[model samples]
Target chain A: MSDAASAPAVRAAIGDSEFDRDTALVPRGPGVHDIDLSAGWTIMNAVNGGYLLAVIGRALGQTLPHADPFTISAHYLTASRPGPAVVRTETVRTGRTLSTGQASLVQYDDDGTEVERIRVLASYGDLDALPDDVRTTAEPPAMPPLEQCVGAEDGPAPGSVSSPIADRLRLRLDPSTLGWAVGAPSGRGEMRAWFALADGRDADPLSLLLAVDALPPTAFEIGLSGWVPTVEMTVHVRRRPAPGPLRVSITTRNLAGGFLEEDAEVWDSDDRLVAQSRQLARVRLG
Target chain B: MSDAASAPAVRAAIGDSEFDRDTALVPRGPGVHDIDLSAGWTIMNAVNGGYLLAVIGRALGQTLPHADPFTISAHYLTASRPGPAVVRTETVRTGRTLSTGQASLVQYDDDGTEVERIRVLASYGDLDALPDDVRTTAEPPAMPPLEQCVGAEDGPAPGSVSSPIADRLRLRLDPSTLGWAVGAPSGRGEMRAWFALADGRDADPLSLLLAVDALPPTAFEIGLSGWVPTVEMTVHVRRRPAPGPLRVSITTRNLAGGFLEEDAEVWDSDDRLVAQSRQLARVRLG
Candidate 1:
């Protein structure tokens, strides 16, 4: 615990955090919220799926009595761009231990036509109230120390498209998985990275939503190219992070019929599994 | 390819399949369907989550232009009993490659008040239209030949409750995982089995939904007992299955704070990966 003198400083830092600012929401009505999709969090022009989920999650946290999202599943109907959007939430059920709800992120074009981008179903609960007892048969993926990994700012592999989200995040890739960064692509469908906010803000349960999908597509390692759009994604936030960079490992187990499944796991600084996600995406090969 | 004489028999078998009858829905209106919940498909007393999803999938298939469910995510709100229920479906979007929709399973209580049981979001497409290109880094779990496994009809381990669903389906458990039934758990947090319909009904894409969740909870192998109610489950159907018994494997990787995540994979007779699922469930320990 820090001394009382640093209390205000901590509060001020949280207030200035870029993630907090980007995901901030303005209440419009009973269950409607106004949000802005920040351009800083994009991969090849499309807004990050996890970032979009976090935006919707913020509104959900405000609409329901529960403060944290335990399980969230979103299906991307269309690609979203940086613009003003609205999140409409409806409470499906409010129980003693958990609350379930649905939310939709919609935007309008010049003609004022509404375009729905993503639809989400989620359940919220107080994560702090959970028991500390834990039993896990899975171990965190192997990763090198922060100093030995390659930073995202080092730039994309030679011919790949630059990810703007990389600048907003402190992401370091495991050196061995970077063969795709060069001409020689490793056939292994996996990627491991260390993630944190570039502004040094501690990651919370909300940001873990973004952290789950912030890495490059796992299909990249298997020599498949082009934009791989996510059709559906589900994330389970197991616990709150312990205030440091997160360990993320993603793998594509099967690619067939122009589609692939990527499974991701996020571990906190304490090496506890904080989140897990699986996304189904379309893969186009040249 | 079979001769013409075998065609009618095959058609007749499918028509008589119990799975088809139980999940059959009657069109009540444009988007509403009336269905009957079958008690034969229950674990303890609550209807099986996967079976409920398949019933909803059937409705979604009828409502959407696309026929097969490619991706589906369902949140279980309340336990459902065997009786008359209604499934309401809404089309979200129709795309060239995929179509998205939502569905709700509801029933009335003694007071005639409506109660919703499960809510689902799913995308549908034609599995046969998908390209045949295949690349995989994951392999099916190893299991002994079908004749060597322990049949479900042999009865539940010494003190466990008998599953009615098991009697309706031909399910066999790998011998190594049977320790839990004999009062000693393997502590591996995993279960593998062979699955088929007892009526010799050929498993199709729709029935694949049931096979994904038709197993004893993986937590049972870890010495945890009692009801493990699924809070949410998401399934991705990779492709249609080959006609024969299906291989199913489920594993529990993490259990903390009264919740556990079970990941399941189903392989067809031809050893092709047919479906994959991950479910979050509540676990109560004595």
Candidate 2:
């Protein structure tokens, strides 16, 4: 679908709803609350981590109402595996300057099976904070212009790879960092670059969360299986990247026992950290 | 109770179990071969993350059906919060030398709100691998001996920093790293260490998960209304640390708004990395 055409679908996928009221709550203590495991609930299995995060995000929204707030940056710390998890929410002091709140999701099996947990910290602030600290360790280098971008409707397309996500969005690869990005037109209200992802599928918000969760991918065609879902993801979205010839940079830090973490930045035609993100992942051979 | 007498109590507290067959099956999966969330099943809630991990460790022991095995090092990326969470498990691969499995938990509210999702990658290996490189990155400094460690019998002599954990364990703060740990005795079983955990009060295993999901007090002591739970944690137990002074090294990597992530490493007196953990915390000011 055209970027414009995809709007309704994306909104349906992410739009607000009363279905959110279906959430189950369990009291943790005097002040804390937890999700009740007895509730028959689960999101679409594809992009679970991010979808689950969206649910928590919505709850946080209830805690602190805001405007057309974007998750400029989000950090998810995994506490326990999802089943029988714990959810805690706290309102940060926004002080009339920012809209910020934090929540945690922990999973456990029995009293003994503590599998995973996640912490999500989010803020919605005024747009006035833009245009500061332009300096970065590096910037997205020059690439083919939009018309010249691979898979551009008009340009000479780069040889296609076996990717499902490729079919969903247009792609641009930066020669400098081998960083590649797949995004629809900017109308969707979010900017995303695709360089590496597991399952080789088009990543929705949920898949994006999972992709960053894995360690950075070095060579193409590497598949990972045994990665823990994202422990935390820090996302800072400046202005959405300019539409065409988008630039992306990705780097990985750790790889031990099929587990790793990597950070990525997407830039617009301008050399700014339009969106910066980090994810922790496990690396296992399929 | 004196430190010596309370040592067992602490052990019991950490080793307690509230899980039954129904809870244990939550992580199994979708079909009859797996656990069903639609059936309204849940896991135990009072156990802390560490203890829950131990239970997972135990379950894994049976899953592999191996006689002799050990976990080298496990790192938790997130923490699970209390809620109506569900779990699904898949065995990524099974091998003679190593076996890997993937588990995901999803939390929801009583009204059926989706709270969080967690994915975990766990690996088990034969103990016959080549010895690990023991070159320590940081040397172990001198500290009080085990005898000087306050036992359940000894209790804090007086005017000591009051702790909720059993008195058998006392914290030794290293000036260099500003890290402290409280541990019970050694020789318990497969794992042993001194560490500090928040009191869960009367909360169940779910609350215990939340209490430990907060940022480990390894470094900064900044105040917030409450602590955020972790999203995921991967733990590999290589060798149990000898009962003595346990040291925890905590460092905060990022904190924006109410979301934060802290990385921690637990070491025995011998300076070996017993466990490496990372927690994502959502900080909210009262």
Q: Per-residue alpha-carbon lDDT of model 1 for A1-286, expressed as tens digits?
A: 2221111133324446788899998989988899888999987788999999999988898888898899999999988999899999999999999999999999998899999999999999999999997898889999897767787445556886667786678788898788888966689999999887777777898899999898878887898777899999999999988977798999888999999999999999898999999999999867
Instruction: Indicate the TM-score of model 1.
Output: 0.95
- Range of the 10 consecutive residues with the lowest summed lDDT in candidate 2 chain A: A182-191
Model 2 chain B worst lDDT window (10 residues): B184-193
**What lDDT does model 1 reach?**
0.87
lDDT of 1 at B68: 92
Compare the candidates by DockQ and give the number of the best one: 1
Task: Report the lDDT tens digits of candidate 1 across residue range B51-88.
Answer: 99999999999999999999999999999999999999
> Model 2 captures what fraction of native contacts?
0.00
* Cα displacement (Å) at residue A45, model 2: 26
Measured on C-alpha atoms, candidate 2 has an lDDT of 0.38
Docking class of 1: medium
| Cα lDDT for residue A4, candidate 2 | 20
